[model samples]
Target: MSSEFPTPGLKRKARKGGPDVPMWAARADLVKRGYEPKTVRLPYRLDEPDDAPLLSAACLRLQAEMLEWSSGHLRDPNRFDGTIRSLSRRYQTDPESPFNRRLKHTTREKDAHVLTLIEKAFGDRLVPSLKLADFWRWYDAAKKPKATGQPERVRRAWGIMKKLRELFAYGVAAELDGCARVRDILAEIRFPQPARRRVTLDLEHIEAFIPKAIEMGRISLALATAIQFDAVMRQKDVVGEWEPIPEGEALTGIVLNGRRWVNGLTWAGVVLDGVTRKATTKTGAMIAHDFSLCPHVQQVAAHVLPERRVGPLIVDEQQGRPYAGDAFQREWRKVARAAGIPDHIWNMDARAGAITEAEDAGADLDAIRATAAHTDAKTTARYSRGAVGKSRTVAELRLAHRAVKNSA
Candidate 1:
């Protein structure tokens, strides 16, 4: 109490003659200056050698805080206190969660499904303790509904695991304590990469498809199939709402901005001049195509144009609303069955067919790339089927000629 140097405001009476005491309090002037002077308290006796560093740290922090500086821990509580369940919950519901905000709606839906599977399998498992072997175990046992082979179900489960890898990667970037281990385990567990084998339609299939759809009284489906094949548009573009040009507006031709059309342009309301601007949803790339130049596109447009009134471009004749993507697929399968086309071929194959046709027509890589809105020219190659067969035929001819020359 009778010390040579005493804290400025620390009173002897307030001390109660005990080492355990409030070391500091905020001054009135500091509070008036918008500073919340913090009180530094020690858990143990202040004079104890073991608590000296702790008391010193608290005092330093209090001093720094009064001077408008940060001294306390700044670590995210979620990062330290998190488990797989907590992180998954935050990823789903927390607006501040980065992945929650960044993932697209369709992607978010898939992620939610994956999260459900993960929760069911490893919800209580600590993120750090998660092992690569555990993932393999889960993968081996995972099965989809009515699935016979392990490959198909494994592929589905593998997709969920990959999504979890991405989520854990985000956690690692955020400096979450256990996420690095989870991310690493996910990385080392190698699943078979499924080949991107798409059943691309041929020109003959398209010719047959249209007539059968017409016969089935699915006029919108028939015309939409034709447009999808010719314009290289996605089924979503065909069936989704098209933004029509505003009244008295001079803007003509279709302008797709993602799923929505711009400049009052709707798929049903597209005013075909000689060209149109199409923005693909997958790659978010823009490309120009001549809608009027193609006879197939024009013929389909002529057939559907009269029906494109003031609403959805591809509507149900009965409901007069846009066909849902699944609904359109169902109708397409019916037409394909009636047309004597393979049931394995999807409605989406028409777009692939269009890309193949463009490639077969001697369009350069970039030209076909633009038509398909492929971000990579190499990806445009995957959509091409006819060219491979043609190239093989030419190679066979060269081989024959080489044999002849060798004999001579």
Candidate 2:
């Protein structure tokens, strides 16, 4: 074949083709040099003709290129095969697959953390051989013995396992197109049983701790005690802040009046600023309620100097900072010891005590739920058991009375 083409300076040159190349080969050569392929532009239409042949050819070319690359770069044949299998299973067609969407949902940090754990549990060499069984074995090893009273550790392990399982499922779905076998494998796994609900503190036990708090010269301890008794605020919330109620006046001398404290607002509520970053109640809710502050609480709040009013209501005088969760726990232990209460009467005990007291006081279920800010009624029901037991006693007495009358 011979071709005549104009050069940049408008000079024509006859170029001879080597060994009479085919038309298609020549066309490809032209395309390699940046010449556009000739095709008729179709008019806008709702239905388009199938381009399966062209698509198949393109895919074949891409597969060939990938194979060449993998042959050189991927030294491990097993890993390469696994990767190819995963890709095919996840997407019927890689170009339009949902793998990218799934990948986008996961963070690099989370993946790295999970991978580290997996690698540590199973040596690096065995990590590549990780199956669902390997994950379960790792989880079992991580769990503490049932007799250890380390239910929290077991729960943590379960959480980690669940997260890992989700990641695995996502990978299988996206990389293997969808792995029903993996899903079936995960379905058989069961989490460890959670700890039973143990109400560790009673009203009497908490009341005993107040004197010790007062004796320790911990001003905020008195407030915390009062809040725990009155509002069902968790330990974290009770100690977080002591905001002044709008148009509120501070409680004055305690001895002068039988009432321990009086606030401008009907209820001495904590002002919860949603924007602030801090630990919240387990339910992630805040409460503002009217409850009578204890006489000791009134006394302590009044005594604080004007300069120390900022930050959390509870403060460490030495640190000149608000007492954190750990600090509060430590103080609580000390207070419990001084009050002649068992060490089990920790901060959470106060919350449980409040719930028990409220139910005993004949507060309806709705009222208790509102105070606790529980998302589910089931949680509120847990606290209402004490109240239910008391009610059942009354009902049993009435039933016995009727039975005696009938026998007579």
Candidate 3:
């Protein structure tokens, strides 16, 4: 091959008996300098059609790269600049940064989405110069087209502010210009917290939902509801989770849709005598559940299809794969609707409902906390927010105490 037309950071090679056309390749020198997009292949033109526009996405990229390289800003992202965009890029790209190292994969994914928006909105804003008024304006921009009191708008605004807080803290840690003052300003400002969901998956709702789900031929939904309601487990625990398959290794784990699926309640977790043990994903606490404790668990266990008995306890019948986060919610919602479960009662409320039920049944607070796999009793108490049965029990106890006093 011979270079018919030579270009910096690109080249066009020619072969004998080949038409005189340009075939572009990124210069090997660019790779030596660690420039990204190591190779650039310009889009070829169609000969059958008349002369088409020569510009392409690859050409634009090359142009940008050349300009950046000439301007000595090619490695700017690698260095810390006192800009919001620089801080965000560091949080996103640095392998050892808290964003990538400390947070869960799911959490990092959500933060990454917010990071892109943050960069676009405040890319050039310097952290040290960020004021409360300016920050509020940025938040308003995020909540645009959604009015005050809208649940989604407030939730999204809160999420964006939370990410900004984290980034500012990171900037402070890195000793970037003006981040410390901004952090303190953010501390004094009151960001609207997302409203807590008050609707709970009540006992009556659960009872109705389970049989309806089973009758509708969604045994997995029934099993999941039973397990979650009885054991106070998160839906993620029942549906399991999927992890990515590592590169350059033999593919072994449950690889579905090109990702490794693992850790949602596998059949193997269910041991002899109806005792099931699994660790919580959020907290590393090990939970040993005796399915015999809840008759609902036993009922669902008896109805488990033979195939389901071999793999995960709740495999999606349609995909034959462990339920993903969104898919799991959708399927569960469908069965919930069919069961006449109210729209406000989310699948997540099942944990709270179970805790409330235990509290009403006179179960010890410590026991309920352990059942919910919460490290703190206070955390467990939050899940029982919508529980009215416990209040009724308390009212009854007070009346009985009054009666005893009168008799005395």
Top-TM-score candidate index: 3
List ranges where model 1 is wrong by over 4 Å: 1-82, 96-98, 143-145, 149-151, 241-269, 305-308, 389-408
Residue-level lDDT of model 2, residues 1-408, one tens digit each, is 112211111111223962221111113343364432111111111121243343333334334434444355532222212222322223322433443344422243444465455435432221123457766776777676756654446765675676556544655644442244555566688877556556646667755666567677766676676666656666656555222232354554221122331211111233322221223434456555543334434545566666655644665555555553367678767777777887654667666777777777767768788777777768877755355545866898999999999999
RMSD of 2: 18.2
Of 1 and 3, which scores higher on TM-score? Answer: 3
Report the Cα lDDT for residue 225, model 2: 69
Candidate scoring better on TM-score of 2 and 3: 3
lDDT of 1: 0.64
| Descending-TM-score candidate ranking | 3, 1, 2
- In candidate 1, what are the lDDT values of residues 89-206, reduced to their tens digit? 6567656666566875556766788888776666645464566777777766664544554345656767867867877887787777778877877877777655675678777988
lDDT of each: 0.64, 0.49, 0.74
* Higher-scoring candidate on lDDT, 1 or 2: 1
Off by over 4 Å in 2: 1-119, 122-132, 145-153, 169-184, 241-286, 293-311, 384-408
Per-residue error at 128 for model 1, in Å? 2.6
lDDT of 3 by residue, 300-400 (tens): 77787556578777878898877765888898888889888878889888898888888878788899898889999998888887556667878999999
Best by lDDT: 3
Q: After superposition, how far is residue 58 of candidate 2 from its true place, in Å?
A: 27
Steric clash pairs (candidate 2): 86-175, 89-176, 89-177, 90-175, 90-176, 90-177, 267-290
